[model samples]
Target: MLRTLSIRDVVLIDRLDLTFGIGLGVFTGETGAGKSILLDSLGLALGARAEARLVRGGAAQAVVSAEFDLPQEHSVLDMLAEHGIAVGRDEPLVLRRVLAGDGRSRGYINDQAVSVSLLRRIGDELVEIHGQFDNQRLLNTSVHRVLLDAYGGHGDLLAAVGAAHRDWRAAVDARKRAVDALEEARRDEEFLRHALGELDDIAPEPGEESELSRQRQGMMNGEKLLEAMNQAAKDLGQGRGVERMLRDAVRALEPMVEKTEGALKAVLEPLELAQENISEALLQLERASQRVDLDPNHLEQLEERLFALRALARKHNVTVDDLAVLRETIAARLAEVDDGDAGVRKLTHAQAAARKAYEDAAAALSAARVAAADTLSHAVMAELAPLRLGAARFSVIVAGGGDADAWGEGGWDRIAFEVATNPGAPPGPLGKIASGGELSRFMLALKVVLSKADPVPTLIFDEVDSGIGGAAAAAVGQRLARMADEVQVLVVTHSPQVAARGENHWRVSKSAAPEGVRTRVEELSRADRQEEIARMLAGERVTDEARAAADSLLQGTES
Candidate 1:
């Protein structure tokens, strides 16, 4: 629902702010009283393109803000969230639009700046407006089937069909991709044979790259280790300096054993044993470092071996360990190419099944639409009679195509709404056949019937009743009142009867400012509304008769 609209320096609306309620709101005024200025300003707020001419003469820019109470699941709220605009669930979405005299425009949602296109997208979701000389949506044949379904309250079933259709299409697309891949692989059968043969010949293994490099290093340094080993051997057992020293010590200890007795003998024997053990360890270390190979040919071979592995790894753009995985994948692809027909057959079968499921769902929805169209046509016709279109013939036509092009949600056939103004004449398209007044009446009937199902939060009708009055006008007013129970309805009307039906009423008038003009709006009290209605009924005069008629009009509905 539109909670409020504020305008600043927009055409004749220098500054205006108005709060709204759930039920019907009527804006009434005489010619040149700026009723249309109000609508135009409101339109600018609802994402209409900016016009420099609409800017007040003294003002460099114009600004309009529309605040809407959004439902939890509204698509606009999702869009806002996606754009990083924070709006609480069930919170009012305060959309603001500003227009500069240079023709630049800006928009905002919940105080966060937004692009104009986004505002247009979000605005479209929140409000639906119909007007004279404008292309009203209800008259569009393309959407007639969906509208009929909505009128019949089949939104859930349509939603189910939509989900099923999307899933089916996705499956079909996946199968197509699989089949395409299989076909492409068949063209590479010979290449696969060659590549796999090469990989199989090489038989690369994980960890082989690091092992080869280490082996090459060890072989190159073999001579250096051998030279160091021989020198250490001469110092130990081969030279025998430590061994000679230990022999002298042992002889000295033997003499002490008799002189100092067993205590001195134990200490001397331990020192002699320690020297002998150290000499033996040095001999083992020297022997272990002996030159195993110092051949230049062996080192050359190791260098070549490491280079071969590195070259192959570079050619494959992979570390040697990843070659195995690459080879496996190639083998798989080659196998798939060899069994191309088998894979294609599987994919084709799956695609056929998915397409069949979507078709079946679409066919059922089409049947349901056919049934719903008949009932909807009858209901709308019933509504038309009270609006003085008793002679009009309304139609809901379902076009050709029994099953071939069946689709999701929207069903299998092309659908349209047709009408004939006079009995005996052939029924024609609604927009072409109906006059402005007839269009308004038709739209009003459609809205009343459709509002309960796929309802918009706010509805604005701009002088839709321009050519209707009397009992027909009364019917239009009554239906508008009834629709208010479902959604907020704002009517820019001239009919006294229509004015009387609104739970909330406002009078739109103009005031001249220093630079240009300004629009003013005020909610009317009971007495003021009575006078306004009477004034509307009688131009330039509110006689006793007009007052009495206005009283009767207001009294009859009591809305």
Candidate 2:
């Protein structure tokens, strides 16, 4: 609900502050008494396009501010949260806009500066301003489906449909990916087969390559190594070698021991130890020579296997040890190719299941909407005739079947509001067939029917009672009052009946200032309200008859 509106230097509404309440608040004045300045200033504050001409002549800028009392769960708070704007529930939301004299505009939400577009989006959630040719979301045919769904309490069903649609799309995407992979594998089938065949023929083992390399290095120089070992063994042996010479020395030392005491004995012992060490060295050389196999055929076989492993490694761009692992990977991919059709079939089944889920949810929502259309149409029609549109017929048209391609989160429904303003005229779209006054009244009726479902906290009608009077004006006033019971309502009206319906009444009047003309609005007391309504009825004069009529209208509002 709008708490207050402050206007400064906006056309003739300089320094005007107005407070609004829960019920109907009306602003009434004569034909050129600056009645529209109220709405224009409010519009500027609500993120409407700025006009430089709105600035007062001597002022550099114009400012309009509106304060609204928002509930904790209001969607406006959610929208602000999305934009990272924090608000305390105890504080009212304030929207302020400034129109500079040079035509640049600035916007603020609770003193936090925001872009014009963002301000407009937030404003859209806070208030809805309806004029005769209003192109607001309510009148747009595209949003009618949402309005109908909200009114019918189909939120859960709509959510289900949206989730199911996402699942279906995901299933389809998964199937497409599987099919593409299978096709790619088939294209490379021959190459994989040949590579696997080559690996199988050679039968490469994990550590076999390193072992072969070692064997090859040994065999390549086996003959020369064995010859050197044989010579060493012969020289170290006992008979005609170093061991025999040590033995002869030991015998000579033993004879000397008899003559020269301990010195000769020590020399003989060292010579004996030398002979034993030489024999052990000869034994080791013999064992090594026995282990060397100097066959040419063996050498050739080792070289051949080593070269094959190296070649395969080069071809696959891998080390020799990695070839075995690569072979396993290729084999797995070949097996997958063999199973491709089955995988595709599985995914196709999943896709079908998901589509069924979506269809079920969408069908339920569609049926509910079909029922809601009739009910909503009737409710709106009940309001039309009283607002001077008795000849107008309202309808809710739901179009679309369960076509997969045209599916949306709102289900497969295209809803539109159509009307016929003349008795026998064919009904067309609400915006197309209705004249300015007819459209406004139609919107008013629709609003009255959908007020509970609408999230907008404030509804402003800019002379919606444009071309109608008498009972029609009173009916418009009555509906506005009814709507205000659910939400705040502000109307700029000229009709005395509408003026009398205001829970809070304010009068707009213009006077010549020293510099120029200025507009002012005053909250009317009971006596002042009577005189104003009398002026509305009697033109330039308020006679006893006009006063009596105004009193009657005010008394009717009380009853």
Candidate 3:
């Protein structure tokens, strides 16, 4: 509900602040008294388009702010939370907009800067303005189904239908994927078999490629390595080699040690150690030469195996290390191809089951909608006679035949509200058949009937009561008063009968000031309200008769 609206430098509204409460509020004034200006200012605060022309003539900019008391579980608070804006239930949600004369504008929600689009989206949930020219959401055919379901209390059934639709779509997708896979497998059957055979023939093993390459390299350099090993062994083991000389020196030192005793004993020990190291070196060289592979045939064989492994890897478009894994995957796919028909059959059965579920849910939803249409049509018709639409008949049309192409989550039915203004006339769309005044009354009837289901916190009616008076006007006022019990109601009206029903009243008027023109609104006291209603009834001159009539209307409203 709108708690307050503040405006600054917006056209003739130099500065204005008005507080509202939880009931029907009416704003009334003479023609050209700036009632429209008041609504326009409220619109600006509700994220309507801002224009440089809206700024006061000499002012540089204009600003408008609207404060709303958001309930704890209201959708507006959910939207705010989604945007990371924390709005406590105890705090009023303030939306502020600034329009500069240079055609620039900025929007703020709870003091956090936001895009105008976001502000507009949030505003849509906070308030709704219904007038002849403004957008009338009730006229939209798309909302007709939602309104019907809401009235019918079919939320659970609708959810079930939606869930079933999703399940059906998922089943269809799974079947399609299975069919595509089968087709692809059939197309590549020969290639897959041939690749599998090739991999099986080669019988590649993990780590085999690196081991073969290393052995092949060793064999390729075998001759040079063998020659160097032989040379080393021959040099170390020959008769004139260091080992023979060391043994001869050891024998001579043994004789000298016998003559010199202890001094020659240390020299003989060093000679004996050198001879032992030479003998061990010869043994090592002999073992090393035995291990070398010098045969050219062995090298050729290793090269052939290594090259075959590499060529097979290239043919399959995989590295040698991946060849084994690819073989397993190919085998698995072939098995799937053999089982393809069974898989397809399973998926087909699942899809059919899903379709059946959806049809059952949709049929239930359609039946509920049909039942709701009858109840809603009767309710709306009941309101028409009181609003001076006695001859008119309201109808809720259900276009449901379960055609596949027209199926939707809401149901197979396309619901719309239609009207026939006279007897035996074929009912048509509400927008096409009814004049502006009639449409307003029709919408009013629907609103009064659906007040308990409406989620919007505030509703503004702009001159919707334009062409009715006396009992009809009073009926409209009475309906508006009843709607106020569920949601905030604001009406811009000229009828004294309607104005007299206001729980709170404000009179808008314009006057010439020294600077320029200015529009102002004053909340009326009980006596002032009586005079205002009298002025509305008597026009420029309020006679005693008009005052008495206003008094009677007020009494009727109070009672």
Q: Using lDDT as the measure, which candidate wins?
A: 3
Candidate 1 per-residue lDDT, tens place, 149-175, comes to 776676776776787777777777877
Q: What lDDT does the true structure give each of the candidates?
A: 0.80, 0.88, 0.89
Please provide, for model 2 over 269-340, each residue's C-alpha lDDT reduced to its tens digit, 9 standing for 90 to 100. Answer: 777887888878877787888889788998888898899989998999988898899899889878879998
Number of the top-ranking candidate, with TM-score as the measure? 3
Candidate 2 residue spans exceeding 4 A from truth: 198-328
Better of 2 and 3 by lDDT: 3
Tens digit of lDDT per residue, candidate 3, span 1-559? 9999999999898999999999999999988988888777778877888778889899999999999998669888888888999987599899999999997999999899998988988988888888876667789898888889989999999999999998998999999999998888888989999999988998889999999999988888888898998888877767788988998888777777767857988778878887898788788888988999888888888888889989999988899989999999888888779998999999999999998999999989999999999999999999999899999999999988656867767768989999999989999998999888898899999999988777778999887788899889989999999999999999999998889889999999998999888898999999999999999999888999999999999998898
Q: How many collisions per candidate?
A: 1, 0, 0
Stretch of 10 with least lDDT, candidate 2: 232-241
Question: Over all chains combined, what TM-score does candidate 3 have?
Answer: 0.89
RMSD of 1: 3.8
What's the ranking of the predictions by lDDT, best on top? 3, 2, 1
Pairs with steric clashes in candidate 2 = none
Poorest lDDT segment (10 consecutive residues) of candidate 3: 401-410
